[model samples]
Target: MDVPFDLNSYVRVLKLASTPSWEEFSRVALIAGAGVALVGLLGFVIFLLMSFVPGAGL
Candidate 1:
């Protein structure tokens, strides 16, 4: 038996596939950059802490 297609769902999918406006794109970029910066800062702090340990090689 063949499955029936739903037009409403198809239309919704198409609507969501459109490109983002500049403002939306910029906002996403800013958020992503902040996330990356936070991860980098955390890694640096961990590295510094490890360096102070006696057994850890510099």
Candidate 2:
């Protein structure tokens, strides 16, 4: 069996891709940061709750 690389397909994809404007980048960054902070807060809450469990061993 043999496989072939499609260079033209990759080139076409690259041509279609564009960098986000500053406003777009700022919105994306804010949303991503909030998501990460939310996840961290949730994990910390879970950890704090587990520490109170009688047999969790902290």
Candidate 3:
């Protein structure tokens, strides 16, 4: 058995999709992604530093 979905429905379902207000959502998502990347880089650096320190016992 198979189910059907009207994927095209979302393309026309929202008047908000074209409004200037929508750009803020995009900006917020970009910033959140960048913040996550920064945190991951910092954590990796810390891990490397700890691994190199004598008897850090990480």
Candidate 4:
């Protein structure tokens, strides 16, 4: 029986993950994504409301 053994890539990723810059960038990305989602939901609700009003142009 023979088992393959190699973890260099995993170790490199782990090391990169420990940097503070990576954490800050991740936070920024999360906030940006949340903002985009909020805007999209708000727009969808507005469209739904507009559709319900009688005589409104489609």
Candidate 5:
């Protein structure tokens, strides 16, 4: 049996999916960049610590 498509639900979803404004985009970008930088710094610190370990194979 074929399922029927729900046009009403589709329209509702499309309505909710509006484009972000410039300020919203900039705020999101700044938050994302900060998160990435933090993770990278954490990874570098872990690498440095591993290098100091007795047999970390670094």
Candidate 6:
């Protein structure tokens, strides 16, 4: 049996994948952090609302 994944292809991918610059990395991190914070806030709001519901057992 022969394998389809060639070592040259892996080398090509490694060559193409470059490290993100500081500016690019920071911008992406800020966006991702904002997204996570927003989702967490939304979840917290939902939890508060659910806690107020009667007989829901929290």
Q: Tens digit of lDDT per residue, candidate 5, span 1-58? A: 3234577777789999989999999999999999999999999998988989879854
Better of 2 and 4 by lDDT: 2
**Per-residue alpha-carbon lDDT of candidate 3 for residues 1-58, written as tens digits (9 for 90 to 100):** 2233454555457744665567888999899999999999999998988889988754
By TM-score, highest first, what's the ranking? 2, 6, 5, 1, 4, 3
**In candidate 2, what residue range of length 10 has the lowest lDDT sum?**
1-10
**Most accurate candidate by TM-score:** 2
TM-score of each: 0.66, 0.83, 0.56, 0.58, 0.74, 0.80
Q: How many backbone clashes does candidate 6 have?
A: 0
- What is the RMSD of candidate 5? 2.4
What are the RMSD figures for all models against the true structure? 3.6, 2.4, 4.7, 5.5, 2.4, 2.1
For model 2, the local distance difference test gives 0.88
Candidate 1 stretches greater than 4 Å from native: 1-15, 56-58
lDDT of 2 at 11: 78
- Model 4 residue 54 CA deviation (Å) reads 1.2
CA lDDT of each prediction against the hidden true structure: 0.88, 0.88, 0.79, 0.82, 0.88, 0.89
lDDT of 1 at 44: 95
**Model 4 ranges off by over 4 Å:** 1-20
- Backbone Cα, N, C clashes tallied per candidate: 0, 0, 0, 0, 0, 0
For model 2 the TM-score comes to: 0.83
Per-residue lDDT of 1-58 in model 4, one digit per residue for the tens? 2233347666777888764598898999999999999999999998988899877746
lDDT of 2 at 30: 100
Supply candidate 6's per-residue lDDT for 9: 78
Off by over 4 Å in 6: 1-5, 55-58
TM-score of candidate 3 versus the correct structure, residues matched by position: 0.56
